[model samples]
Target: MKIPQKPNDLNEIFKNNIIKLMKLFEEKEVKEFIGEANNKYIHWDKLRRLKMPGNEKPDMIWALIKLSRMVTYRNIKFNKYVFNYSSLSEFQKRLHLLDKGMGGKILSNNGSVIISSQERERYILSSLMEEAIASSQLEGAVTTRKLAKEILRSNKKPKTYSEQMIMNGYITMQEIIKIKEKKLTKGLILKLHKSITKDTLKDKKYEDTFRDNNEVVVGDSIELDKIYHQPPNYKEIPKLIDELCEFVNNDEKEFIHPIIKGIILHFLIGYIHPFEDGNGRTARTLFYWYALTRGYWLFEFMAISRIILRSKVKYGMAYLYTETDDNDITYFIDYNLKCIEKAMRDMNSYIDRKQKEQTELLNIVKKIKNINLRQAELLKEAVKESEKPITISEVINTFGVAYDTARNDLLQLSKSGYLEKTKIQKKYLFRINKDKIITELK
Candidate 1:
C-alpha cells in the first residue's frame, strides 16, 4: 500500500488567500465546508474530488479537512499516540443502530433457537474453526477451508506449516475464551503470541518475546520499498505496553465504548508491532478477547476474520487511511464495525439455512418413525451433512441428557436403521445410514 500524501499545512494554504477564505466563510460556505467533511469523514485525497466547482484548490480543501478532525487519545505511558477522528456522522449512527439491533437479536430467545441452543458446543466449535482458518489465511497461510476443517475436526496433528498456523490459531482462540475475564497484561500477551507462533516462527527465539533488535515494516508485498508504516522504536515498547494494559484494564481517565476500545487495542498492537512475528494473529486474538470479555455473547458465533479476509486490501487501507491522514481512527473503526455487521448478516443467513434444514429433517423423521423430539433433531443433523458425526458426549452436552439416555437415543436410531453406528476406541459414533435414510425418507 502506498502511503497517503500528507495534507499541506492549513495555515500556509490560507496565508495567501485570507480575504477569499473570509468571503467564502461569510457567504455561508462554512456550512458547505463542514458538509463536505461530514460526508464520510474521508481523508483529503479522497475528499478532494467531492469539492464543489469553485472550491477546487488543494490547499483550501486540505485546510478544511484538517479543521474537521477531533482529537482522541489512547494513552501509552512514556509516548502516547493520540488519535483524531471526526465526530460520529450519520453513517456511523445508522451502523451503530443496526449493530445494536443485531446484537439484541442474537441474545434473545429466538436467537438461542437460531444458534441451536441444544447444540451450542457444535456451534461454538464451528465458529472457532472458521475464525482460526480465516485469521491464519489473512496472514498468508495457505489451506482450503474444507481441508482445514477436516484436520481440526478429526483431531489430527497438523502436517504442513500452513496447517500448523491454523491449528495454533484454533488453540489460541480456545485459550482466549478461557482467559477473557482475566485482566489483559504483558504476560498474557506474550502467552498469546507463544501459543500462536509455536513451532511456526523461523526464528524460534522470537517466540514469546517483543522485538528488541529486529526492525519491522508494514508495506506493499509486491513493492517492498513503498513503506506504509514504521512502528515505534523497540525502546518504547515496555512503557507502551504498560499503557496498553492500563487502557485494557480500565485504569484510564475516560470511558471508551467497549467495541471502540477493542478496535483501538487491535489497531495499536498492529501499529506498535511489538513482536517480531505473529503480530497479526496476536492482534486479532486480542480483539476477540476484549469483545467477549465485555459481555457480547453473540461474538462467540461471529467469524469476523472471514469477512475481513474477503476484503483484505480494504483492511489495510483502513489502517493506512488513519495513519496517513492524521491520527484519525474513524477510518479503522468504521471498517471494523462494518465487518462486524457483515459477519452478523452471514451468521443470520447460516442460522436460517440450518433452521430450514432442521424443519425438513424433523418432518421427514416424524413420517418415518415414532421417534422422540431429540431423536428427530439428531436425525436432521445427521442427514444434513456428512461432516456432522455424532458422539455420545456431544448428544449429552447438546440436549442436557444423561449419558445412558443420550446413548439409548442413538442406539434406538441405529437399531431402526436411521443411523449407522461405528465403534471408535471405546465410544460409539453415529452417522446417517445413507442408503437406509435416503430410501426411507424418499
Candidate 2:
C-alpha cells in the first residue's frame, strides 16, 4: 500500500504528455477513430480499436505481438518514414529512428532497450495484452509452468532473471483443452512451483506485494527509486482475490466481449498482486487463461509476451504516466487502446503471411506428378496438426515406422518436390502441399 508520491522517486511516475493525451482522449470522437487521425490536428494520433475479428484470428499472444505491427503500420501511414525500405527490418529501423527523434521514446519513458523491475508496470502490460487479444481473437490462458517452459525453450542459461532475460516471452502456453482435463495436487503444484524463484515466497519484496502490506509508502522520506520497490499488503489480500475470482468465474458479463472482460480481470487481479514473486508473470498468464476460457487460439504460438518485450518502454510509460495524474485511468486506457490497435494490424499481417505460405505449399503439392493414398493421409495429418512446422521425427512416430524407412520416405518426398524443408536442427521439418493435394483429389 506504500505508493510513491513524486516523479523523481522510483515509485513515483510523472509523465505530462500522457496527462495531456488523456484530456484529449476524453472527446467521444476519439474512441471512434479507426481512420481519422491522418486528417486531424490532434496532439496525439490515437488509433481506435476496430472491434472487428481478424480474417484469420489469433490467440492472446498472437493478438499482442500483432498490435506492435499494427501500430508500426499506422505510424507509417500517418507519419512519414522518409525512406523506401524494401524489408520490414529496414522499415522498422527507420521508423524507430523517426519515433525516437519525434520524442516517442521520451514520451514513452523508454530510452533504455530493456525495462527492469517495476511490478506495477508488468501488471498494467498484462491487462493491456489480455484486452488487445480478446478484442480481435478468441480467449485463452497462459499457465505459469507454461511460461517457465517458454523461458526454458529459449535456450538461455541465466538460472535467474537478468537483463532482457526477464522478458515474459519465454512462458510456455498449452491449449486450455490440454489443461482442463487434468487435476492439480501437491505434487503437480510443487513440481510446477519450481518454474519461478523460491525466495519470492518469503522475500519481503514478494511478501509485501502478495500480502498487500499497507505500511509501505513512498513519502518524501523514502528514496525515489524504491517506491514501486516495496511489497503488497497481504492483510486484505483474500478479499480482492475473492472479488476477482468471483467476477472471472461467474460474472454476468460472460456475453461481453471476452477481450474487455479479460482486461477488467487483469487490472483487478494485478492491482491485487496476489503472488510473492512472479506477480507480473502471473497476472499476464491469468489474463491469457481468462481469454482462453472464453474460447481462443491454441497455444502453438505466443504473441502478447512478445509485444510486451517489444514496446516495454511504452508499457512502462503508461504505468508512470498514470502516476503523475492523480491515478486517472484515462491515459492507461489510451495506452492499451494503442496496443490493441497494433495487435489487430499485426494479426492481419500474420494471417496474410500464413495464407501466403499455405498457398505456396499447395502449389508445390499440385505440381507433383504422382502422390499415393499414403502421402495423401500424411498430408491430411499435417494440415490437421496446423501448428508450427512439423519435424521429421514426428512423421516417423505418426506411422510407427523404422527410422531409415521414415527417413527414406521424407527424403524422397522432399527430393521429388512434394514437401518443403523449412529448417534442419536435430531433425528436419516437412511441410506438405495440402492445397495441391486437394486440387489433385478434385
lDDT tens digits by residue: candidate 1, 180-235: 78999999999999999999998999888899864688777899678888888889
Count of backbone collisions within predicted model 2: 40
Q: Pairs clashing in candidate 1?
A: 84-328
TM-score of each: 0.85, 0.44
lDDT of 1 at 365: 61
Supply every candidate's count of residue pairs whose N, Cα or C atoms clash at under 3 angstroms.
1, 40
lDDT for every model?
0.78, 0.41
Candidate 2 on 1-442: residue-level lDDT in tens? 2332332321222232335344433545433342233222111112222222232211221223222233443110101111110113433343353233332211112223221232223223333333323211211222243343333333334354331123222222332224543332222222222333333244635523343456543222346554543333666565545545555565464343444455545444444445544445555555566655555432112345555545655655555444443333334434444554465445445545544544455554565456543354456556666464545554443443456866677677677655677666665778876664566556
Q: What is the lDDT of residue 160 in candidate 2?
A: 43
